[model samples]
Target: MSHVHVPALASFLLAAGAAFGQAPIVGDIEGKEFRPFPIAVTELRLAPGAEAHKSAAQQLVKIVRADLELTGAFKVLDPKSFIDTDGLTQSTVRFPDWLNVGAAGLAKAQLKDEGSKLVVELHGFEVASAKEGLTKTVSGSKDDVRGLGHALADEIYRYFTGEPGVFRTRIAFVRKVQGEKHVFVTGIDGQGGGQVTKGGGLNLLPSFAPDGKSLVFTSYRLDNPDLYELALGDGSLKRVSSRPGLNTGGRISPDGGKIALTLSQDGNSEIYLLDRGGGLLKRLTSSWGIDTSPAWSPDGANIAFVSSRAGNPQLYVMGSSGGEPKRLTFQGTYNQTPAYSPRGTHLAFTARDERNVFDIFVLDLRTQKVARVTQDQGNNEEPSFAPNGRMLVFSTTRSGARQLVVSNLDGTKQTVITTGGEHSSPSWGPFVK
Candidate 1:
């Protein structure tokens, strides 16, 4: 039937006006979208005679506020008219000052210079309950203050959302520019992006180690798209597997103990598991047709993957220990890239309907009921669960290019999180810290 479901990622989108406006701070979707919980951020002051670092403190506050705003789950309140606590501390916060501004959550801090080291005190307060709160202290050199601000924002995120903050996490994706695709890594908010691969070869489908210290991707540097591991912090690339045929789509298990990927050295593409040391543990599936895109269950007891053994690619769940897989998708003509949620209960994948349109869908393992994640769109594929299981990162062809997009699980507040050219195959890393 020639069931080819891997379509180029393109999707519909809504306009974001406030995200483009300039204020003390700006959140991407404020009105008529997934508005983040209202929060206030104030710049803390330094000690007397520290006037030289006053500008530094102002920059640090904006840096922190901008981060939490990107989550698309927060509504960051501008501090322009809010009371300015030059030297704000937890005890010094005037709760009404933020409450009057309609801020449900507030952040106040102080930046101090302890000799050559700089220290920051950050706090998250809930005005309604006046009980949900957190205090964090980060110390580093002047250059590291920016990094610490991101860390502080992450802390506030966790305290309020119960979701592990992704403020400090990094995202690695492949981008196509001028007809050439290159791999790049950037911080969670799509900032500080840099090239990780330098070659005329076409590189794609780069997956990261759970720790994000390294990456495994398919690169055709020598005319062969083999899987290679590239270490970050340094621009070193190691070819992990270049089996005579195709080596692509590397996915590391959650435990960081094994990697499951597609291979065709045997003349047919199938799924195989490689141990942490790069030793082949076992072939996961061997069908006369194609079986690819293997995602490991959170417990490592089973694997959720896409197989065409049923005449069309469909979602299948097989024992991690190796056994015949049970197909999970029956209504769709094709389905692939089965991603397991971090909570270990649901599976999300790209399902293609008869109209040849693809959208994100979530299936609850307990009930086997499928729920569409993205509504009427151009095309939405490769849905990945955020750490909190409340959101996802996928590839969409909106804003005039194929780029990475992030949205809640229910597709309530969808947002395109990238500004780069044609990007796809976004793999969100686990909590790094």
Candidate 2:
């Protein structure tokens, strides 16, 4: 399979923000030889007479530590190993103490209560340079204390990585409870999860709208495997596609102007392009074998999908406007569920090995190189890239029950976030503003 080169979409790079700034902490991420940087986060302190900040103070440190630990680029030290837990103030941080603890970076925070809200002051510093890297303040209602932690984590991440973190993003996944499958939404840390589909009979394959306020998924509520759009604002559900049979794998384009999905209304499983309102625009593939799991490139110029036209299920790349298809995978006998990274440099999917176990693999579009992301971990599948393109979320059965797992791009720092339920088909949502 050769790489397919297409003209660049002018507005692609500007979607996330201005051109992405170089990572403040540089390493060879593609080469997978970079060592994780040792970072230490001090326990959050509470202002005097602010007993209301007790719980939130503890939560702030927990969330920030978890977020940085998941990146794989940083090694968060245990708080018990800190010598100056309460003395590392913004103006008085002792970098020598952190360096003695084998940490190259240090983070400190303080929490205060204001009437009905909580305010947080966060700071980051380089242990080697002994210079402050970040100073910011975040505030939110005490009821939403977790949100403040996420905001502080994002600031710390940007201070050290230059790129924004997806701590504020959400994830949509399918969880089967008591033999019924329903769509559920959760924060990136797996906290604050609740069902989005209440009247659902069987809901699966959830794809978040680019705006992060809606989702497109396959449902059998009307006694058919039809597609439905779920509005998060009002819990409203509208049928997007109720064609004769097999309406599944619906993915909204990055620009939100089009949708590329698998439709079988024509008696053959194939990929089709649809307007945002579900009106058929054009059939992208007409194949005898199943062609499904269409993912849009960041530029919206190409789509990577799975098909069996090569005698076995493999990945294929084609133009979004309908054109000749080029195969993309040659190493795996079975490859499906292709997801294009937000950076447009790689495609992540699930591949089955000779031992009949499934794991995630990433394909470098530029070099046509395939790198295995998970192995010997109980059947990991359905990888979804975080908005930052530095992390991914997938479902794994390593704990004897399906759970959502988050990992870095190089397959390091894998952590299972969800503890209960049979969760699968996780899709990382876009950055929330």
Candidate 3:
């Protein structure tokens, strides 16, 4: 994939003699009541002599608008309601017209086609005070318009939320095709990626390494559920663990030096640690109950996994170096697939309720509070948090085909991002540099 080059076009400062200060944070992501910020993204303006790139410009605008809406933090206004189509310059933007359409912020961009690259000049404005808050220029290969769009979306997200965006990141999931299940990777928006595994293997539970260059998953290609690593750049495969029995749920540590996975070599399923090359490091759990699905915290200080030591499946947390495990969930009879947030403040997991329906829930480590993320829609499972920790990607049967869904922390904004197959076990990858 070609890299998107972003260079500063103008100083990232508010207009001189502006009437208002920096835009206040839209809403607290962790709060109960979240009011989406109203914003308008104007149609892309083609520079003089750049009319040939009109189709690309329209696609770029669609990508940015869709990305902003997917975050559930901004309500992108309809272009039909826009009263100002004069130009993209500061003097031509009518702040009163934007406010009249309930837009507190406005975004505009102009596209230019260079000899071998496409250039975009992006601008963000605060409608209330008519102050320009952001100005950037991004460029990429002529064939990589999507990359440029995602890069611009990331910049806009950072400008408003003071946090990095996951638009440029990727996600790995298992999709069944032609009677075989394989691992596939795609952009978080579920576009512009291809299958990562082949040879008719039943690959599952794919997780990304910290550097986002490769993935670790369990494949039954050899008649045993063994852990294998696939390089994203070259499609090369290497066996990481092939014990006598199950060796699944391979999750890399935050530092990218070790892996935590479930092993059943000792006659029972237990959590074990291994080096990147599949060498044994330590056995973290030894209980008779089945222990699996290990997840590492952001700081690599603790590991969370599911265990049945208490007679039922429950989530537990233990030191990465091996220690007594502490249970974290008590309300649900069955809870598994624990995924820690990027900030290590919460844990998202799958829980089965009294009605035998599985749903996703988040547990706040600080307040010991559990929040329901999905309900009554379908059987949702295997939630993976985005790099920003503000959203989640998981598989849901709400549409009767078991497609992947990306949802905000509150479940207020859920979007089906995949189709045409039964997708499951989503693992949201880290940001790509």
Candidate 4:
């Protein structure tokens, strides 16, 4: 599918600080406690000739609200509490009415049908000062209401937080179907996507290339745990590594030039580096104990992996070009699947606590401080960070069925993104272009 293009309709400066007369609405995401910024998203007003698009507009509003709420930074006020629902312009909006309902920000949009396309005029206002802070016009195919909604949500998030939203990003995971594990890709909300692997025996450990155009995973369709890269655009598959023994846990480097994976061809499971193709570049680890699940740092300077060289499977970090490994986790006896944040400031991995239950934890690289992300929530593992580094997607068993869950950094807000089938090994894709 072609990428959707969303352009601003006019040049409007955001006077958020001056309008609110307060600090930024969103504070440190890593902090232990936070008060969600209350924002009101009004129903999309139907233009004169767009009366037929009521359902589409409603769906778009729902998508936008869901995206904003999933960030754990914004609380979308209920529409029932809105007093001025017909206001789509600054002159019509009553700032005091919104402020009375505990809304600091307001979002209003108008939907229009342009024959060949659908155009939406989005307006954002600061409810405290009756000032407009954002104005955008998003257009797409009539069938792409979801994309239109996500684009608008992203604009609203950036206007306030100064960071790109992950609404348009994709996620990949392994889902069991007909007793075989297949790889699937979907939007962050786990909607409007389909299975990616076919004729699959068992596909596992799916990771995305930095470009967001391809996915690398371990597939046993050919009777061996070989590494394969599947192009997401054209459905083309290429075998990246097929050693005599295990070739699994393939993670493409952030630069998209190399792959770090586990190989057992040397009679021991060790981390190895390979070129974009199937050619071997270097053997990164020579430990007698198992070393696997290599994850690259955002800048491609280092890698984090699970190693048993310290007697128990624990997290370790090393230079990408072969260097002495440094242990990162001391409290957990079993740690695996290390995933570095996009900012290179933290590492999220799965650790088994004293009760032998697996959960997610984050380690601050700067302070050497460890924080738990999930606790007593059934077994959660294989955490993959979103491109923004503020959220994570992992497999969880808390829903009675193994499913995929997206969680904020502190585990306070977690929403299951997949259901019905046993899912695991979720890898959140990079931000879409």
Worst 10 residues of 2 by lDDT: 1-10
lDDT of 4 by residue, 74-107 (tens): 8899989888754788888888889999998898
Q: What is the lDDT of residue 243 in candidate 1?
A: 79
lDDT score of residue 182 within candidate 3: 91
Residue 13 in candidate 4, Cα distance off native in Å: 24
Model 3 steric clash pairs: none
- Ranking of candidates on TM-score, top first: 3, 4, 2, 1
Q: What stretches of model 4 exceed 4 Å from their correct place?
A: 1-24
TM-scores, in order shown? Answer: 0.85, 0.93, 0.93, 0.93
Best by lDDT: 3
Task: Look at candidate 1 and tell me the lDDT of residue 134.
Answer: 73
Count clashing residue pairs in model 3.
Answer: 0
* CA-lDDT, candidates in order: 0.73, 0.83, 0.86, 0.85
Error of 4 at 126 (Å): 1.8
RMSD of each: 7.4, 4.2, 7.3, 7.0
Clashes by residue pair, model 2: none
- Model 3, which residues run further than 4 Å from truth? 1-24
State the lDDT of candidate 3 residue by residue for 213-236, as single tens digits. 999999999999999999999999
Compare candidates 1 and 3 on lDDT and give the better one. 3
Candidate order, lDDT descending: 3, 4, 2, 1
